[model samples]
Target chain A: MNEVSKPIPVADAETAPYWDGCREGRLLIQQCADCRRRRFPPHRLCPHCHSANADWVEATGRGKVYSWIVVNHPVPKEVYREEVPYVVALIELEEGVRMVSNIVGCDPHDVAADMPVSVFFEPADGGMVLPRFRPATGAA
Target chain B: MYGLRDKYAIAGVGETAYTRNSGVPVLDLAVEACLNAARDAGVDVKDVDGIVSYNFGDSAPAIAVATALGIPNVGYAVDFAGGGNAANLITLSAAAAMEAGLAKKVLCFRAMNGRSGFRLGGGREMLARGVTQHTAPFGWITYPQAMAMWARRHIVKYGTSAEEFGSVAVTFRENASLNERAMQRAPITMDDYLASRFIVEPFRMLDICLESDGACAVLMTDAARAKDMAKKPVYIMGGAYGGGPDQGEDLFDAIRWPDHSENYAAYIADDLWKSAGVGPRDVDVAQIYDCFTYSVLMQLEGFGFAKPGEAGAYCASGAIRRDGELPLNTHGGLLSEAYIHGFNHVVEAVRQLRGECGPRQVEGAEIALTTAGAMTCGSAMVLRN
Candidate 1:
């Protein structure tokens, strides 16, 4: 057991599989087995249909920058100092599911709405891989 | 739906001086506010059997306040969890308890030492758990970030300009100059607002609310019992608390994800007016919760003061000024006034209805509307003199 200096995702029973999928370089989304609608941030019962039964499915990992905010102030935290003035964006996947992640591999100021992006995994401090996004440069 | 309409009235409102440093404990602030509220209502501390506050862990609990006040017992007490979302709910709970004979004199209050002790925006945590695990790891930990997202989407859709956002901060600062208790009273121009540094893109330094050390408390009782109180009663004409689409279960997925132009308050806009038996035009003053300037724009749309993409123009035309069609946030709101969550707005609503806000008062103000935090879980109330 090791301590992680940065805040990492503490996966509970409901979200463990999704985090596990991220570690495997796959973006896992929840699809209701009955209603067959997709959801993000993981849930037990289907948010759309209230069906207790659901399945983990891999997503295309491609989304558009639905909206974003470039934080210019330095948060009063030692761990977040290096990441000052970072862009935190709501990336909406092609499946119509949205997730919050940081935009990397591009200038934070260059981020814009409807800009194409793709999921990219980074090794976090907790020996786990966290899913992030980079600007989509090539064709789907 | 309107059964509780006018059933309760705010008998008294009290608050500690807004300051950057209180040099006291949060519990002390809470007790001071409660005692002042009880005195304002001409009620003894012993008569307050119902105590209610927000569920946020910042303030002293209801039982803590009662114990410190030397009350023997409490018939009803609840601490709701949402921040500004719980402002009006605290009073609504007190009113309901008093009307049901659960308690005679109910005390609702909020106290915080945000500047001296802990700043709500100075760290990497959300008020509630689970919602920010995905975001906080990436420094997306503050409310302004979410609000920035909402603002950018609105701008892209409606062709809103940064000048529109500056107008909101400028209006609040202008009103704050008239409020002696306001934290920022230097006054600002649209040029000053434009030149301010950006905290979160689309939101400048002036777009955010001030973090001050203060407290606000109000006493609630039945309308019939309010006539016997010392001050003139401010009746609770109507109130509603509710949530909108996709906010229920997971809480992570929003109704329209990045586009949060629609809010929970809009769902109950008609219901609130119908309950109060008035329309938006009847509101003489408004104290809208303004965590960010853009949020005020969203709320104007949600509460039907302006059409979806028209709030920017509406505000730009000076319609929300102190002498405008709607004298909004006359106490300067959180942008310039102290932020005790949204409780300060409620106190201002009561003052406007009673015609106690001297320089910033809305002329012939018979009705007032105060809205809690918007976009997420929220609440609103209509008050009448």
Candidate 2:
């Protein structure tokens, strides 16, 4: 695994199970047992229904390019300098969750809003897999 | 408007120098001014039990400040997570805490040299971490970039020109020059605004705010508790907060289904108005955020002060000047003043209500309306003496 100081997400009893699932390389989202609406970053309750009844399920990992920004500038000294001028975006995951992520396999300028994309997990620091995006096959 | 009427008073205000090249640490500067606020309010640091700031806050500022001021068992502490809305959000939270009796005094602040320290314009770090993973590649890389694209669409609809956009920069400088706290305090002409070097095409260097390493803070407390403090209390008549347009499926999705009419820029204006239980005409003094010139323009229209494109003309008419009917950003603004997000705007509003600002003071100032900028998630307060 690549060396890193590793971000220990605030994983307590409420979040432990979620991280355990991520360790298995499966994307899980919280949905209101009552409303059946999906939400991201794993919360305690449903934003819509406020129901507590819920379970974990694998996401299809298919989403469209909702909004994005192409970062092509100098690197912050604190971060990996080798990753300079990369394209970072805000992907609206198919699960109705918006996450900050980077779009790989393309130039920064090529990123377009509404572009079809899918998740492609990449090896990250601290023996974990990070979610990234790639252009979907035959996507608009 | 976040319900500020004489319900609470801003007892003190302080700031550090605004400069990007300064080698000072951001947290130290922030703490320095916070302690200064303690003195300005005619109280010792030990009196501080409530501290509310932006979620973007660094722990160093508050933690070190607590230790330095000998404030023990802080009854209230929070960091509201929203960009640009830091000051206003803090105000709302402070007022709430005061109303709840959780604390007798609350201090709100924003401190950073995002320009000097973070180098957000570089965007490389945010990109590497893959934050904002799906925005736009060729465009919308930074705040100005994202706003520029939004502005492009408005120009097409409103027939507003780049020069019209330039008017925001001109107004900011005109007001900032008179403000000693402002960084880019220089006399600016419309021609100079247009002709100045372009940082982003159509967005001139003059149009953007300065990058500075500084911190600013304001102290607010219950209206009753304020009487014993050094400064008179400014009531919190109203307070409101609004969100920005939801992340649409596509850029066209945003443009096609703009829930926030051009009159209010985006949804935050709608949220603020609803919270205040009033509309645009209720505002007496205005302190609209000015991260860039267009931010002010969009906010003016978004807040329903004018029509979509009418902001350009309204600003040009000197209505937003320091001495104008709707005096604005009398401490300059992020553009001319230090860019500690929108923190200073709140302080300036309090000064207006207290009648402390001599030449820039708006006489008989009773109410102040402040708004955070686009992608809006800020709190607005109507303050009256």
Candidate 3:
């Protein structure tokens, strides 16, 4: 595989805390204070109740594979050409929120829908750490 | 109530030759298409007073096209800031303008050198924005990969197979063989579709749309003035645009969208049929936006042509062929024809309604349906001759 670095996540004002949580090896999601609904990719207001008041809560990091794709054609070839056929999936957390992440620790072809997965952190470009998912084990 | 139905008509449609390299400025293509549309309608260019176009910052502005066309005075002009989803909306906006007495002879068009310049599939830095910020770090950087995830969800939920998706590609290619304007006219079978390399899991190269350089334009006016035009007018029966619940301002926000298998079509289908005063069974032909083969399947289910989880079988059963019950993509769609940002689909629908598609024509096709975009926010319209 090529040694080139991958694109790091650029955190904006709304998503800074989520990245902060990832840097600390915690999976954080926003929960609306009004309706008690949780959401991902941190936003300004609750999509459900339109409340601007929300707080970041540490998640269980346990999710199921809702959907996934094995990308064979990689763009930004320098960064991903060596990672062809990597599995990228939408993980539906136990809290009922979905987010995008990589399905590691298993064969890309073996990944299936509803497969239970748990999150782990990995170092990325520029000292940034990203949250990825792998098949869940009995522990946590 | 339903006031826009049959109130305005597309009097003429025009398209430049679909090519990988137009070798001209986008403005030139826009002007060429506008002139061709005016000529097709027998409407003097000097009398054209309004313009509408859409792009992702890759096309000429409406005012620039108007300046090129030399319209003495522009009564109304606007450009939507989007891609394929804006195709039908531009026409709808133009028709609404005419209905509101804001302008007459409004020309709606889309022009792009998609192959030679600013390719949708190419590696561009701007694509890594918004929701992509969360996914791009994991090598999920392009549209096909994101859409493939949705396609995979459909497969898991509905038992959709690769062969079934391939059937859509095969059918459109068959239709394209009869279309001289199509970019990939050489016929391909289901075997060829299966053999094509995968771009992403559940999506082969054949299943994806062509990246083409082209332009398409349609002229709209009041129904009264349409009767005097050079060609038979295709009335704008009804249409709807925008997103539904769970669809945020960002594109492909599948994380918040409740069902990955469902598309924007489901939310708007009822309104589309209700306003058109016609059911899915009444459509004689359909030009479904086929940015990807699975998109066609999703729209088929979304538009009520087939029940959810049944579009795969419906397509594989030869139901979308020209001789089938619901002739679809008669001009080969974006898959085999060319991608003019779905504007070409509108042009083909107008031609089919006018009986101008000599070889690929649906015999006596009176009513047609055309959809734009998939996954994200979308739009659709019904047309009648």
User: After superposing candidate 1, which stretches have Cα over 4 Å from the reference?
Assistant: A1-4, B125-129, B248-258
* Candidate 2: segments with Cα more than 4 A from true spot: A1-140, B1-5, B55-61, B126-131, B136-140, B244-279
Question: TM-score of the candidate numbered 3?
Answer: 0.97
DockQ of each: 0.52, 0.08, 0.56
Per-residue accuracy of model 1 over A11-68 as CA lDDT, tens digit each: 7788889888988899999999999998877878886789989989899999998878
Q: Encode model 2's per-residue lDDT on B227-333: one tens digit a residue.
A: 78887766666766655444433222232123222423355666566655667777678888877777677778767888767887787788887667677787778
Q: Report lDDT (Cα) of residue B262, candidate 3.
A: 79
Q: Which stretches of candidate 3 lie over 4 Å from their true place?
A: A1-5, B126-129
Cα displacement (angstroms), candidate 2, residue B30, comes to: 1.8
Best by lDDT: 3
Residue-level lDDT of model 1, residues B1-385, one tens digit each, is 3678887999998999999999999989999998998898898988888999984578789899999999887999888776787788788778777767789889999999988987887765422236556666666766676678778788878888888878888998999999999999998998899999998898889988999899999988888889999999999988878766667333233424434766666777877778888888888899998888887888889889999988888888899999899988999999999898999999999988888889988889998999987666678899998
What tens digits encode model 3's per-residue C-alpha lDDT throughout B171-264?
A: 9999999999999999998889989998899889998999999899999999999999999999989998865676754564567777879788
The best candidate in terms of TM-score: 3
Better candidate by lDDT, 2 or 3:
3
